[model samples]
Target: MKKSLIVSFILSAFLVTTLSGCGSTSTAVSGSTDTKVPATAKTEKSTTLRIGYQKYGTVNFLKANGELDKVLKEKGITIQWTEFPGGPQLLEAMNVGSIDVGHTGEAPPIFAQAAGTPLVYLGHEPASPASEAILIPEKSEIKSVAELKGKKVALNKGSNVHYLLVKQLEKAGLKYEDIQVVFLPPADARAAFEKGSVDAWVIWDPFFSAAETSAKAKILADGKDTVANHEFYLATRSYAQSNPETVKTLLEQLAKVDTWSKDHPKELSETLSPQLGIDVPSLERAAKRRTYGIQPIDDALLSEQQKIADSFFKLGLIPKEINVKDAVLPATK
Candidate 1:
């Protein structure tokens, strides 16, 4: 009799909830949390938020003129966008408090945090090792990673490729000091690699793809096992915590653009090509290889990121080990 009474009560509650949820237009957070908003109700505004982004990373026109801006605009907030060449520079800007939010890859944030940069990882993206690599001239004599010893390799120092080259050398049983590291920007490195000044170029796509097709560069090795090459959305801890409401809407919009980009790769390239001034073909090539979804800052992801920083320390690229979770916002987990 007691079991039957409990079952009856449960069924009654389910029936009530089922009927109450009929034709719902807004997502209800909980039984008591109000989610319904009148059409005339304006979303309350919040603090000023500045977002930074690089040309080749996730922050293209997606933040500049797309739905993210529109989403935030709807909430009566304003966003200021600052552009960067690479993650290292962007982190530099962040460390100096030039901006509050930006997107970068795994390695730069690791290096930046090691050097006492104050950026925090808010979230991440799906891992894709193919996004970064080491490219050589197609007909070059360097057939194996071992042959890179004493060879001039051009790379952006302290960027994602910095750790990649270290791991590549270690895989070949070579010490980090065995190779001549030529630190160069992407543009200068392309020129130097083309002029035969460097034996190989360690770079990320669409530069890697361009080097393969137009520059006739061969990929000697890629991020395989060395990295997952996951893109990270970082922000100032103070900024993210103080402006949760603004950040929440902005992240949702980012996820929205990511979903749309996945379904419409060609559309994404067509939209970004003109802004980047890099032709549709190159943009399309990049879009094909990249995975565009933001990830919550789960423990597993943080563990992997910590390993990345630890590896840099083991290889002597960094003087001391950094607790990656410390740099991560407290609300990160």
Candidate 2:
């Protein structure tokens, strides 16, 4: 009996020890009170500024120069570039958080604002009214914007050219409905223009220059006496609000590039030719038509933007009216 009692006591002691060890391990894993994290376990979040750009513009020039990247790197901000087919597409990317900063023509931002995209205008290039135009084939009989009545017109909807078309029609004393509008992107529009599928194609350079050179398109009317055709630099509202200094740095760099580009049209064309896959002659023509010099958004520009918005809303292009000033970058104190 005593031997059996001793064996029972030994077994009980072993059970207690094993159970206690398991309880301790369980507490350590699931119920520990320690709150300190190790130095190696901590990580600093990295910041990357995503920039959206189209094929031909100041942004493209900026990207090709590599100067902006070097400047940004010194400030611990890395740049990620995404190329979009046009301004509308670039702003669409901005609306979806794919890009933080981008450049676009005047009309895309109006549509974006109406659709509730949180975008703000950071700056604008001087109005290059002659840069965009309504072009007809060289062999075509169309002589004036007034002659476009009941004819088929092709343009990229919601582009800067859209407003130009509207204003041109109004100037010709023709209703917007008078012309049968065909919406197509630059490549398709160029194809249509070549195949005689479109009566006239409203476009901007370097496509304008390309069409003139290769497709034998002639300018019917340009924005010279009509629209401002301002090229705008834009950013997500959150980004501009949070990174004001970065935005300022970008505009400053663009200003410097603009000054350089104005004096070196030949060099600009040569530099952009290989990158754009366009001939130097065509690019040179485009460079001449283009105006450079970045300017801050001001009351006068806002009034012009508001006019565009009002016109679009009146024409039922955008669903709702939007205040242009609402999308301007908040003035820094």
Expressed as tens digits, the lDDT of each residue in 220-283 for candidate 1 is 9998787788888887655654555566666666666777777787887787777776667777
RMSD of each: 10.5, 20.8
Best by lDDT: 2
- Candidate 1 has an lDDT of 0.73
Model 2, CA-based lDDT? 0.80
Least well predicted 10-residue stretch by lDDT in candidate 2: 21-30
Candidate 2 per-residue C-alpha lDDT over 68-172 given as tens digits, one digit per residue, 9 for 90 to 100: 999989999999999987888888898888998999999999999998888877777889998999999999999999999999999988999999999999999
User: What is the Cα-based TM-score of model 1?
Assistant: 0.83
- TM-score of each candidate structure, all chains considered together: 0.83, 0.85
Candidate 2, superposed: residue stretches over 4 Å from native: 1-46
- As for candidate 2, its clashing pairs are none
